[model samples]
Target: METFLGIDYPTLWFLVVGGLFSGYAILDGFDFGAGAWHLFFKKEESRRIALNAVGPVWDGNEVWLVIGGGALFAGFPVMYASMFSAMYIPFILFLLFIILRAVSIEFRSKEEMLWWRKMWDISYSVSSIMLAFLLGVVLGNVLQGIPLGENFEYQGGPLLEFLNPYAIMVGLTTLALFMTHGAIYLLMKTEGRLFAKLTILVKRGIIFFVVIFGITTIYTLIYIPHLSDTFREDPVMFAVPLATFLCIANVPRLAMKHRYKLAFLFSALSMSFMLMLIAIELYPVLLISTIDPQYSITVYNAASSEKSLGIMLNIVAIGAPLVLAYTVFVYSTFKGKVKMDETSY
Candidate 1:
C-alpha cells in the first residue's frame, strides 16, 4: 500500500536509512577529520581546541548509527539476526573501540598529567583507526556477501569470511572516505597553524581517497559481475556514487577562499551521498547471499506490519524536523574559526 507520499514500505525504508546515514555523515564527518588531525596539532592547547570544535555535538552524530541499528532491528529482523550472529566478534570489537575513543576524548582534558594525556591521545587515534576499519569491512562483507548456508546462516565465517579480499578493499575504501570527510571538516573549522595543517592533510587525503575510492568502486563493479546490472536496472542507484565524488572534488576550491558555509554544505552532502550509494546498492534486499538467493531479506518480506510502519512514519514526520533544526543551530552557533585559546569538551 502507498503512504501519504505514494511511497511503498520498501521505498520508505530506503528513506529512513538515507536519513540515518545523512545524519552520521554530517555529524561524524567532522569528528573524523578533526580526530585525524589530532597528530598534526603539535601544541597541546591547539589540539584541545581542535577537539573542542566537535565536543558539544560529536555524541549526537552517533545517534544516527544507533538509529541505524534500531531501524535494522525494527524494520528488517532477518538481516538483523543474520548480520549480528555472523559478525558478533567484529561487532563487539567495534563497540570496544568506539568506547575507547569516547573515553579518551572526554577524560583527556580532565587529566593534566602529560603522560596520561599522551597515553589517551594514542588511545584515541588507535581506536579510531580500528573502528574505521571495522565499519568499512562490514560494508565490504555486505557487498561481497558472506558464506551463508542454505538456511541463511553464515557458517563459513569468523576469521575466514572477515578477511576476504573484497572485505579488505571495502575496509580501505571506508578509511579513505571517512578521512576525506574529516579533511574537509578541518579545512572549514580551524585557523592559523591548525588550519594550515588541516589543509595539507585534506589535500593529501582528498587526492588519495577520491582516487582510491573511485578505483575500488570500479574494481568492485568488475568483480561483482551483477553490480552494473543492478545499477542499469535502477538508474537512481548508479547516480549516487557519481554525484558524491563530484561534490568531493568541487567543495575544496570553494572552501579555500573562505567560502566555508558552502564547503560545509558540500562536505555534508558528499558524506551523505556515499552512504546513499551503499543503501541504494542494497535496495529491495537488505542482505543478499552468496549461499542462496532465497535467503535475501527484501523490505516487503522483512518489514513489520503495515500498521507499525504507519506509526513510525507519523513519529518521524513530527520529530525529524526538530532534530535537524537543533543540529543546524549548534553548528551555526559555533561557526567561523576556532583558535588555540578556545578549547572545551
Candidate 2:
C-alpha cells in the first residue's frame, strides 16, 4: 500500500493499464474503422486509397495493444490469467482475426488477379468488423460480470455463454461506433466522389451509432443498473457520460459542417470518454464476480507487489513518451490526403 502523490501502487498501475488501452482504442480505432469500410469502396482506386490512408500507421498503432497486454500481465497477473481463461475462445478468435486482417492487408496487393484482390478485400473487411464486434463482446461480459469462483477461476457454463444478449448488443454497438469513426477518418483522407460518398456514409454512421448507443444506454440502465450505481453515488462522475454525449453528438454536427478534422477529434474524444466511463464504473474492481462478491478481482487483491509496480512505472514513464513521440511523428509525416504512388498499400 505504498503511496505516491497520495495514490497507492495498485491504483497507479490501474491507471497505467487503463491509459494504455485507451491509447490503443483511440489510435487503432480509426485503423479498424477504416478497414471496416473496406467493402464500401467498390472501385479499385477507392479501395486502394482507403487502404493507403491507414498504411503508414496501422501496424504502429497496434504497438499500444501489445504494450497494454504486457502491462496487464505484469501489473495484474491473476486478472490476466483468470480473464483470459474465462474468455479463451473469444481471445483466440481475436488473435486469429488479427492475423487474418494483417495478412489480408499485406497480401491483397501482392497479386493483381481480380479474384485474389476481391478475396482479400472481403477478408480484410470481415476481419475488421468481427474484431471490433468481438472487442465489444468482451467488454460487455466484463461489465456484466463473470462467474468466478475460488482463486478467481471462472465458474461459468459453456463458452457460448459469452454471447449472451447483452454482449451481442454491445458488440453491435461497438461495430457501429467504429464504423462511424472510420468514416470520419476516410472523410479526412479522401476527396471528389469518394469524399462525397464518405460524407453520406458519415451521416448514416451517425444515425446508426445514435440508435445503437441509445439502445445500449437504455438496456444498461434497465438491466445492468449496477454500472450506474457509481455515478448515482458520486454526482461528479455524471460529467463523464455528459461529455461522452456531447462528443458523440458533435461528430455528426461537425461532419455536416465539413469540419472533418474537428469531427475526427470528437470521434476520438467520444471513444476516450466511453472508456473513461468504464474506468469510472469499474475502478478498484478489475473483474466482477457473479458467483459472489468475495471472488471478484480488485486492484488491491490482483496487483503485483509495490516494488514491482514502482519499477514498471519508471520503465513506462520512459517508454511511453517515446512511443507517443513516434506516434506523433508518424502521423505528422503522413498528414493530409493519401496520394497514390508506386509504393502505396
Question: Considering every candidate listed, which one attains the maximal TM-score?
Answer: 2
The residue ranges of model 1 lying beyond 4 angstroms of the native Cα positions read: 234-241, 255-260, 339-345
Query: Residue 307 of model 2: what lDDT?
Result: 94
After superposition, candidate 2 runs with Cα above 4 Å error: none
Q: After superposition, how far is residue 183 of candidate 1 from its true place, in Å?
A: 2.3
Model 1 deviation from native, Cα RMSD in Å: 2.4
As a whole number from 0 to 100, the lDDT of residue 2 in candidate 2 is 87
Residue-level lDDT tens digits of model 1 in 176-294: 76776766666666777777677677677767676777778788778986555667887776567689878887776765666666776787787777777666667777677777887
Model 2 residue 191 CA deviation (Å) reads: 1.1
Per-model CA lDDT versus the true structure: 0.74, 0.93
Give the candidate number with the greatest lDDT.
Answer: 2
Report the poorest 10 consecutive residues by lDDT, candidate 2: 25-34
